[model samples]
Target: MDKNTTDTPTEYYDVLIIGAGISGIAAAHHLQEQCPDKSFAILEAKESFGGTWLTHKYPGVRSDSDLHTFGYRFKPWTGAPIATGDEILAYMKSVIDDDGLQPHIRYQHTVESASWSSEENLWTITARRSDTGQSLRFKTHFLWMCQGYYQHAEGYTPQWQSMSSFKGQIIHPQTWPEDLETAGKKIVVIGSGATAATLIPALAGKCAHVTMLQRSPTWFTTGRNANAMAEELRLLDIDESWVHEITRRKVLRDQALFVQRTKEEPEKVKSDLLAVLREHLGNDFDIDTHFTPRYRPWQQRVAFIPEGDLFKAVREGLASVVTDEIDSFTTHGIQLKSGKHLDADIIVTATGFNLSVLGDISFTIDGEPLNFGDTITYRGMMFTGLPNMVWVFGYFRASWTLRSDMVGDFVCKLLKHMDANNARKVTTELRPEDEGMTLGPWIHPEDFNPGYLARGMHLLPKQGNKREWQHTHDYWLDKDDFPAIDLNDPIFSYAR
Candidate 1:
């Protein structure tokens, strides 16, 4: 590691990873294990680690997917299937400590821009030190982006008329107050996404009453907190590695089958989900208005409820769901388009996230600004016409870490290949033969319509009709294709 005075600035490395979050750590681990001789560093915009897990500290914050699948493949998660924010952060800290990744991580180094030189076969990156407000520069052969998709600065919150007239406190879950006082307060939470689902049950017990207001209902599913198979294996004193492997495979298989059923038999899957909710909430509940979504299952992510806690809260009258459009906010509460008014002492907005690609970093290739919208995504990882750069984009259908692990491994493999061939740079460019291929959206509009992605579609990279240029949400397809992909393909051109 080299550090110069603010007067003169520039450092170089074999690889420079942006974001010290889950994906960034995974990338670092793979690079270290696969290419021990190579030098690398991790630059994080935040002052600490854990990325999303660390950023969100709202009540009932936990993983929607099972930890076994969400956790890294190299590291085994010994906790319950659904882990809390603190537990996940602890797990990541352990990985960093165990792997000695602290020394290589440079927190508060927010990258502002990157310029790639074709003749030099290197990238010049400019970042700002958040603490000192000093400009820093670095050069690297390869750039690895693992900053996840969502914008961390702020979540998506819609503007409501007369919002400031309300005398009570208004909060967004992304910026939850540490000393928030909610005991016996009538709380109204806006939005029916995962955050609202998780917060409703959690705040119900402490608040006078918690109401979830949604414009439309979202699909919700129940999952157990503990893993029965892992518990059984533990009782038999089986090896920890063996237990983790068995449980991980079992969870993945079950999840994959469920996703497959949802795609192949939408009606059956929807009915099953509604039946489970009806059984938990009873016959008198308005299941259609509050539980059933108009869209098909898996069009958006299905919110997970551990042990039916949300349903149980609603059943016991601690919480309620209000399906209505917001006309506007009243001084005391929110007024619905149906002429109903809700009285609340506090309002919490759990709207959604603001999606961003590559951490919103500016890019210039050969002194020319690179517009991602004009570029096509190559193999869902690399961008077409981009050289020595890879972005870690996880699966929307399955656990995020599953795709993270694969991208990390693939990067390692590419690095090894480059070293063996003595190539200075590897670039993915559209070939002349590929000119006939049809250009399409990165993701199918109907497939996934999360608010963040919908709002940021124009800024993201496009996809082609061909498989090599498209991103498949299926983990099974990516698992078999990513590692086995021919790096020497005509689409990917290498040069010394």
Candidate 2:
């Protein structure tokens, strides 16, 4: 039966934004200011806000990238370069409160599905309200999906054979137990990414013996994750634009230089970096087994834990590294392929997460379901033939917020153009000539699988030079092209 219509208020939001993370909040904040008269609401899935910052609770979780470059240019980092989870969360809250965005947000409203109504020229979004446990729908002209991958805080862990019979308690870093009693307990962390690298040292301080299990090695570098020039800019009493330019330029230059040094003179840079690790581990440690990565530099994300601190944790007897493949689990502990048994009370799966395409939500256009695999990405911003919508996804090669910032401004400009011309709907579709275009594997080839790896590798847009088809991966080029993009181009035509 049709639910009670009298009790439910029927309101129209001009724009509907999904997720309350950094990207979503930034979009909302900008949209709220530009279109105050137009109704808008940010529909969040969780009870409270702070998307990734709110979810990731693992110990030693912090940004490896410099905060000045990592954070929003509109909001400068008041503290150190690299910030902890708490500090980042505080910064988000500060932005929300200062902008007075409380009234515009409806928390605990998890969006289940969204479809475009070509007949009505509006997007009907369905969501489940957490508090009342009631189903609600909102009709809006535009939908902004900023809900990132992993669908909140759920980490991925595969089931190993004979693992259930093991006496040890299994834990995932994503949902780390707050009341975990790791003290004096033998712990084994499985996986070799940044999470496992970060957790080993943090848990080592308290646990009796911490062993880091790795299937493959990663290039590790630890440095100050902050912009040095940013601090100097603030002190010099220079203009904000000047501060932004100097900071952004220095960061880009440094990152480029780092890539250059590694690629041009591999032996020198490699020896120097490995020497640092070797020195930290002392002469007795095996460099080949413990430090070297299988792939070239930057092929995978380089793990950073503050200058061989994780290695130091291992060297000082706080933690130990075990490079092996898991064979099976015994009643007391995990058994490696080499017939070595590691007795442990707890096992942490620092495995990884699923690469969700548009946050695992299905899109439909005019009663027809949209298949992402069949469609090619348009200019790395919008998808082909998906009318009246633009999805903003950040670049993997550079900082996320940097690319997202440009996307946000471009959208605002598009909205302004739509308003001026009295347009009802706007959509960007790739030119027919650009169909069937492919891109390089977003995930490392060795790590490729049909499940999680397929989405990122197969669906990511190809890098190009044309503003419409190009993904320059250069910030200056994006700023020049996107900011000056002509919204009234014949390809993106307005409808009555």
Candidate 3:
């Protein structure tokens, strides 16, 4: 809430963490607890914390994944499995307050560029303060990038024909108007991703009719808001820690099993998903046209409907799905390719996000501009040829926090290792022998097909055929491999 109050002429820290989001907060906690003597600062571009949770405020905005695994391992989530944006924000704030990280947080300080100096063995960071329009400079031994991998300035909205002529109010979920009225109005939501799935059910209660207009169908799984296993454990007088542990492991196991089934037996998985939909919407609803997707499950992230809320809204006739391409936006509503016009008072575009890396900040090392596409990813957390830097990227298949927490811990280990050895710099580089290794995209082109990732894949770091150069999405695999990673790997060059 307050601006950074440092009175030092030149602020120098051991570590400078960019972005005060979930990853940044987790990193702060780890540095505070593990490396107690290390000095660090958190630079946030936004006025507030909570990152994605705080940015999105559309109706029915909530977590797609359960909070048990999504939450930090050090913090126990006592709320429901799927929680609202406000609930998640509160949880993040509680962590910041409990960890006493408020003093370290510098809000509205956006990093514009970072330059690493080999001679000085430090990074000189330049940031602009939004409120005062003044440049601030800082130096640090290590730089930790925790800004999420997305362009926060704008969401991806396609240029539909004749959009300007529409009389109805148009809205994007990322920048929902504070005072826009939706009650008693017909609403048309575009796209079939998690955002649209969340908005439809949330707006159905107040709107006259909510229609989900999708070009194609996406997979959806049903889940309860409350955790039944946690409830049972509480009834049995079990401690909160034990309950959290049990629920977290069970959820991870279930998710891994489902992903495995989708890869090995996609048809069976599809059939089971559709069967749940048929049971909820009854035999009358057109499941094939709206619920079935061409790609296998887990290829794109699966949408979760809390307690069948979306299906219930559809079954009750308050909300419906229309799978059709849009021809153009008419004066009254949308004109579809199927020779149908959807009359609506409001149009909500939940299309998708524009993906970015390190909040699109520029980077240079020793006067050479850094192009991320030319570099390879090291352990999915650090970039090849980047020294004293770590980027916090989480698992796509599991809770984001699971990998983020590990990244925080791993960074502390790196810092301590450097301290014990009296080393000044540690850099991960592609070795000469490893030059012959086959290079691949950060994410295999065939593995995941999310719009944001696909749109911005070229700008991200690459991975190699070898194990160390690749990012493993499996939490269980990373849990065993990341901690024990040899700090003395030949690829890592140490200097004093």
| Model 2 per-residue lDDT tens digits across residues 278-357 | 77788789777867876666656666667566887988999888888899888888989988998989999988876666
Q: How do all the candidates rank in terms of TM-score, highest first? A: 1, 3, 2
- Per-candidate TM equals 0.97, 0.90, 0.97
Model 1 accuracy (lDDT, Cα): 0.90
Model 2 lDDT, full chain set: 0.74
lDDT of 1 by residue, 1-496 (tens): 2332376458899999999888999988888888899899999999999899988989999988889999999998999999899999999999899889999999999999999999999999999898887788999999999998988889889998888888898988988999999998999999998899899999988999999999999999995789999999999999888888899999889988988898899999999999999889998999999999999888999988999999999999999999999998998899999999999999999999988888999999999999988889987899978899999998888898998899988898899899989998998888898886888788988888888888889988888888888888788888899878887888878988
The count of residue-pair clashes in candidate 3 stands at: 0
Each candidate's clash count: 0, 1, 0
lDDT of each: 0.90, 0.74, 0.90
**On a 0 to 1 TM-score scale, where does candidate 1 land against the true structure?**
0.97
Worst 10 residues of 3 by lDDT: 1-10
Error of 1 at 30 (Å): 0.7
List per-candidate RMSD values in Å. 2.1, 3.1, 2.3
Residue 309 lDDT in candidate 1: 92
